[model samples]
Target chain A: MSDFLMFSLVPMTVAIVICMSCALLGNFLVLRRQSLIGDAISHVALPGIVASFLLTGTLASSAMMLGAGVSALFTVAMIELIRRLGRVENSAAMGVVFTSLFALGVLMLEWNEVGTVHLDVEHALYGNLESLIWFEGTSLAALVDPRALSDLPPQLARVAWMGALVVAFVVAFRRSLVLASFDADFAASVGARPTLVGLLLVVMVAVAAIAAFEAVGAIIVIAMFICPAAAARLMTDRLASQVALSQLIAVASAVLGYVLAGYGPGWMGLGVSLSAAGMIATLSGGFLLLACLFGPHRHRREALST
Target chain B: MEAWWRALIFDAGYNTSLVTLGAMLLGGGAGMIGSFVLLRKRSLVSDAISHATLPGLALAFILMALVFGDGRWMPGLLVGAGLSAAVGLWAVQAISHRTRLGEDAAIGAVLSTFFGLGVVLLTVIQSMAVSGQAGLTGYLVGSTAGMLAAEAQLIALCSLLLAAGIFVMRRDFLMVCFDPVFASTNGVRVQRVDMLLMLLLLAVVVIGLRITGLILIVALTIIPPVTGRFWTDRPLRVVALAALLGALAGYLGVTLSSVREGLPTGPLVVLACFVLFLVSFLLSPRRGILATLMAHQRFKRRVHLRQGLLAMARDEAIFDDLTMRVLRRQGFIRRDGVATPSGWAAARDAEHEERLWALYRQYYPEESAQLDHRGLLPIERVLSPDTIMVLENRLMMGRGAHP
Candidate 1:
């Protein structure tokens, strides 16, 4: 148990917090019909982090976040520009911008000899979750030690603040967000500034993406940003309850996924642990599948109401 | 640099020639197919389909390793890739069509989850007794540096077939993309054609997986069609031009990467397509950014000139700087803002047209909806000679009442 606590607990907590923040943002993204923006942002964040590493010559988290934030914003602008200028559909424009930028990031990483560093493509995709061990917490009692608690993984603290920030943003602007999402012109008529709220939501998603990226990787960030919230979206019509249920779903998937990835194969005589991020994503997908199959409000709005 | 020039025309070497030929064909095929995909508003479906190829590739690799001790056969892996991509497409359709989720949400979910599951299976592969499991991850970002002759041949053959497939189905694609209900009404089998389009796209993707990898293959599919859209308005022309541009990108990207030894072929290909896209976006004749800006400038100039002439006819000062510039540039006014001879003449014309327009609108109230949109053009440009004659006579007759 102490071994489990020392080896797996902090990483699991980071994963859960990351999921919570991502799921919170996903609720609004799904409702606002920009769910794939998370995927685009996560893909483009690769170049931003790579560019930051190239410029600063360091692995500082704050600088990397700035880089990822700039790229995410850039991705949004480029997608919009392409959609407007190229006369392409929203998803097609998104596909063009994110894939082109991701290719550039990969090229940048390869052009330089950054392959030997900790910032390879694999690390960018799968993250450094497994290696983020809490060295200060040696035994179970160290969990109670204030020094050990203080010295817990920095990602845990980062993801916690990110969760709080996302929660606060959503709570503070809940009415505007809900109103704008349901009807942009109606909300605009009532002084909601739907465009500004949408921009802010993208910003919050970028922040959450950068926060979760290093711990759970880009795949899980995309999965968490979409699956739990989407599943919860089918669960209820009310926004508050949907948000609450998504967080529940997020936390559940993260914990169960972590446990399963760590111990499931061992119990089945496979004798090797699986990837925690991949497992979390798979579990979230499973939850969404179930929700699609059995959720009461799984039909379209007109179908449900009329 | 001389070697670069040689490589550009396929005179570099045997291996270089093979890869370049394969890449050019693949790029053309993707660009052609992507044009239809873009027209259908399902360009991102390629992203979902490509990502879903991972588990299929991994599964094929493991199965082939178990059976043949070498899981790197190009045909088997591509077959596996094509199958999984079709499955992913079905899942996306089922989710969006059956459940309440939007297509974008469905795309995101299927891609990430399928990719994640593939990653789990990859870990399983790593634990197996395979000899050369180290190279499987290349399907993600693609590494063209180690492609074999047989793989290149397979890619070339598939690209040819996909191009043919898209060509044969172009009419059906047009109908289905433009008006699905109408197509179905015409017995076009919209669902089956849509699936065939995706099937052709996934085959191209499976072929491209060896060249650009799953992540960047989407770039080839998206950027080329977007670039093509800028060049022309006709969908057929867009398809042809996009294919040409895709071929050019492939040729240039491969040759340029050959010249510059350190860069990977996939990014070079993508970057090449991007460069083409950028140039087309800003410089293409039909819908280029420069053309649009110039069109806007002309419109602005016309508006300023019209308003300034009206203000001059009303005996008001043309205080707006743009209006003054327009008047001065067109020799309608002097530098000191005094009306020149032509300026007076233009002002008289403007006053007469304003009156004539009022007479027409007042007399032909029913036709005012069409006449209300009259911009900078003179009444001669819009109305027939007979109508203008009648309108001019009415303007002359109503002059005393207006005064």
Candidate 2:
């Protein structure tokens, strides 16, 4: 029973932590009307991973992160350039740049099969939770650190390091991030550097993406980033309440999804990860629908205020 | 270079490239219709349809597999894509009319949920691995290299039909796009026209899925129209230019990929379209940045020349000497320091000649015998004393009456 608790409950707890952090960070993105940027960055991270592999010949977390961050920044820059040039709409530019980069990454992977790049593709697209289970010894160490301090397993140590980094960053920069997100122009007028705030957000997203890639994969990371925030948006108009609700949604979805996946089938069957991601998306969508139906008419408020 | 050309022209693999081209042409024509979809801001509907079609595809595959014990991928894909498009449009309309959700929000809800359902269905289907399921993943990811001659031919036929439909209803479609209210008031069946346009959009998206895939299909539909906008203002011209641009991008993307082993043609094609848009935005003659800047410069020069002439005219003592030099330089002024006949005539033309006559008519509709004798009075004392005073002050100050 304890083993089951450790296998299921512990993982669920970890997933909630990761997913809630993603949703919390994603709030600013959604509020800023840049919800699709998460999707773009997620796709753009492909070339970064591939380039890192080519340069280092191993998927070291740091190298991959650096590559992803740079690529994501590039994608942002391309979108800005497109807008400044006034040649195409912002969304179209995003589609073009991210898709092209992703295609390039696919081509590169095809050209060179250093080792299991195809499997990495699948992992990047859908995530490999089994691999995360094996490689997440670092998280376990952190969980047990208060009770017992021993030489921790390497994988668990890494997970713990990443988790702590994420938490610390969010807590440290919450106010400024929220301010910049709500009205970037206003933030700039009031002596906040919108660019700096934007960079911090992008870095945060990239870090979360890398961390989640270990568990859920890259393609569905978008679901984690977007779904909870979208759901929260429906439930609350206040930023604080939205953030809190999003985290709640994320954590709940993670726990429920983990349980279903664990008990449903062993192997060669529909697993919990994809189902969980899909469920979260569906549920969040449902919440938004309900909000649209029953929530106070925010559009009326907007019209009156304007 | 010669050997490379030969290899490209003669290789068996080249057949695949040709088939892909054929599919793209068909797809591009469909995309031409789909551009109207994007312009209508119903872009996300295409996405909803793509997602909604998944169940149909799965059902078709399952039915075929159970009955014939064979998986026929193309037939299944077609049936699935067509059904989903129809259902998606219906659902969009139903939600909007029956519910209070705005169009964008409704679209967002339907697209995400349907796509999620498709993902769920796809995961289940993958586990089964029926014989026909081998290349099913490729359908989502898309692989132009696998296209066959028959598929190409079918796509071409669809493209021709779409083109014909568009041609037949060009005027109605244009009216609808510009102002649906006006079209409806004028006795056009706006609803039927809109549905037909959407059907064309659906057909294009589904057929293009063979090359561009579902996720990036919107890009193909949108990019061409946006690029074409930079090149023309007329609707017919815009449509033709967009189609040509799309075709060119398709050809270039495929050709570039053939030169290299690793390039994915879909994104390359999109990138090419983006480049064309950028170039047109910067350099096209009528609406491009360069043209606007040039016009601004020219306007500034004209204003400066007019101001310089006015400044010289205000200073009568220095005017005569500077007038000849300035006039020679400007070409509009004359060699004489005093206002030459041509210079005076040009100045009068530039001033409010129409307003001066209107003022004259207001005060003196018929002959004014007293004012007709010009030399009998001082130039300032001509007609109504107030009007003459105002005109004399403006002429002496060298300020144009209109400005």
Candidate 3:
């Protein structure tokens, strides 16, 4: 039982931390009218992972980080380019860029013959927590030397670093992000560079994407990124409260999903990932439905009265 | 390359032939309807409906396997997709009306949530691997390599009938799109027209799903119309052009994918539509960027030449020399800014011209004598005082002045 807790439940604790970070960042993204930007960025990150492996001969976190950032930035640039040059609408531009990038990524993956690259791609999709728990460094040294202070596994350490960075960036630039998100024209009139703020937000998305790619695959990351914020939006009018509630929902869903998947299979030989990401999305949808049915919002009353 | 192309085009696999024709006919009809959808700004509705139907598909598959066996599942899947899409549309409208979240947000919410539910349901279904139900998984990603002839015929017949319906109702559709309020005022039954359009949109989405898959079917319904926009401003022309482009893209997309080992034909077709868009953006006569720029330049030149001619007429001392110089430079004026003898005759004719008089009045209304003193009046004015009589003749002919 302790072994199960250590291996399964403990890893889920890490998932909860990651989901909270995703939710916090996602709230601002959804409010900014770029809800699916996360989905686009995650899919576009595939080629970046492949490229990084080709360059470094290792699936190092730093290399993947740099690659994912470039790909995400490229996706944004392509969307802007399509809009400006082709005169296509925003949704159309989004569809064109992301689908093209995803197709290109698939082509690249197929062309690249490296076995390790394929593994990295798989990890980028489904995440490999079992492998993530092993790292070679101070933690390994501490394990050998009893007198030394114990250290967390390298994967946990990496996740903590990512989570902390996301928290710090959000806190530091919350006001600017909010200004640009709500009324970009007003922000620009008031001397803020909405473009720079937008770039900063994209960068935040890229960073969060890379961090979560190892835990949840690309397909599910969208759920983690958009679901919590969408759910929170149904519950609150205030941006701050929405962000807070989103994080809470995300963390709670992650924990519940992990526990359910972990325990349910034992009772009935039905092993499922509980897909922490999928659960968060499902729960967020449920929350939105609940709000639609029972919330005190005036629109609901008007719709019902009609 | 040549051999591969031949193989792709000539290969007679039952599924390949059926899927291609089915997708083309259905996708084309959808593209035609989608033209109106794009105009109405509801182009993304297809995407919402497609995603919302996933759970229904999964549930239907599960029920088929458990209750009646799975050899016959197409009906179940179609019913599932149809029901879900309808419900999804209603849900979208409900969310938009019942929340301050806005239309796009409501759409995003409905699409993702329903899709997530579908995924959960799919996961459950996949865990219990009942035979014959296994093939349903291919629908998610789409595999045109396995389409049956009956399915193809169904798609073609439905699409053809629908296309005919659209043709019959073209006038009503035009009135509905251009001015629904006016249509209603004229007893057009706007609500029925709207319902018909929505039902058509839903049918197109379901039919297109077999080829494009649920995730990307919106491209078929949207890209062709958008590409059509660049080529024509007339509604009929736009719809025709869009349908043709949609069919062309579908054909090329399938053929190309067959040549290339693993390219997804749906996205490839979308790429082809975008290519059409690019070509039209660069070369379309009226709306293309290059054409507009050229037209603007020509207009500016015309304005400049007219201004120079008016200036020469106002100054008789420089009139001959200026006319020569302006004509030499403009190629229409001759080195003598004069109309030649043609220049002299043109100047004489200009003396009684009402437009010239108007220009004169606009610039020097109280200086008619000054103009004569300055030699701006044609020699005919001095040689034949009848010219002033002719100017009065011209003024009377002008009849209605800017009172």
Query: Highest TM-score: which candidate?
Result: 1
lDDT tens digits by residue: candidate 2, A1-306: 444433454445556666776777767776665656677787778788888889888777778778877888888887776555545556655655666677666656755764365434445665544333322234445446653333322334544566677678778877677778767788888877778978877777877776666555654466666666765765667877888887887777666655544554445354533344444444555555555556553232334454
Docking band of candidate 1: medium
Q: What is the lDDT of residue B202 in candidate 1?
A: 84
Model 3 CA deviation exceeding 4 Å by range: A1-14, A46-68, A103-162, A210-214, A265-274, A298-306, B1-11, B68-72, B132-134, B165-178, B188-192, B260-263, B286-403
| Candidate structures ordered by lDDT, highest first | 1, 3, 2
lDDT of 1 by residue, B1-403 (tens): 8978999877988777888888888898899889999998888888999999988998898899999998888789888887888888888998899888898889888898888888888878878887877667667777666678777777777788888878888899888888999999999999899888888888888899977888889888888988988878898888888888888888887887777655677787888899888888789777777888898898889889989999999999877999999999999999999999999999989888878887878888888766554647878888899999998777666776778
Stretch of 10 with least lDDT, candidate 3 chain B = B373-382
**Candidate 2 off by > 4 Å:** A1-14, A113-115, A118-121, A135-203, A210-215, A265-302, B1-18, B42-63, B82-116, B189-192, B255-265, B271-403
Q: Residues A13-46, candidate 3: write the lDDT tens digits.
A: 5677778877788888777867667767876787
Evaluated with lDDT, which candidate comes out highest? 1
Note the Cα lDDT for every prediction shown: 0.86, 0.62, 0.67
DockQ, per model, reads 0.73, 0.23, 0.23
lDDT of 2 at B158: 69
> Where does model 1 exceed 4 Å of error?
A301-306, B260-262, B370-374, B400-403
From the highest TM-score down, the ranking of the candidates is 1, 3, 2
Model 2, B136-168: lDDT tens digits are 654554556556667757666666676677767
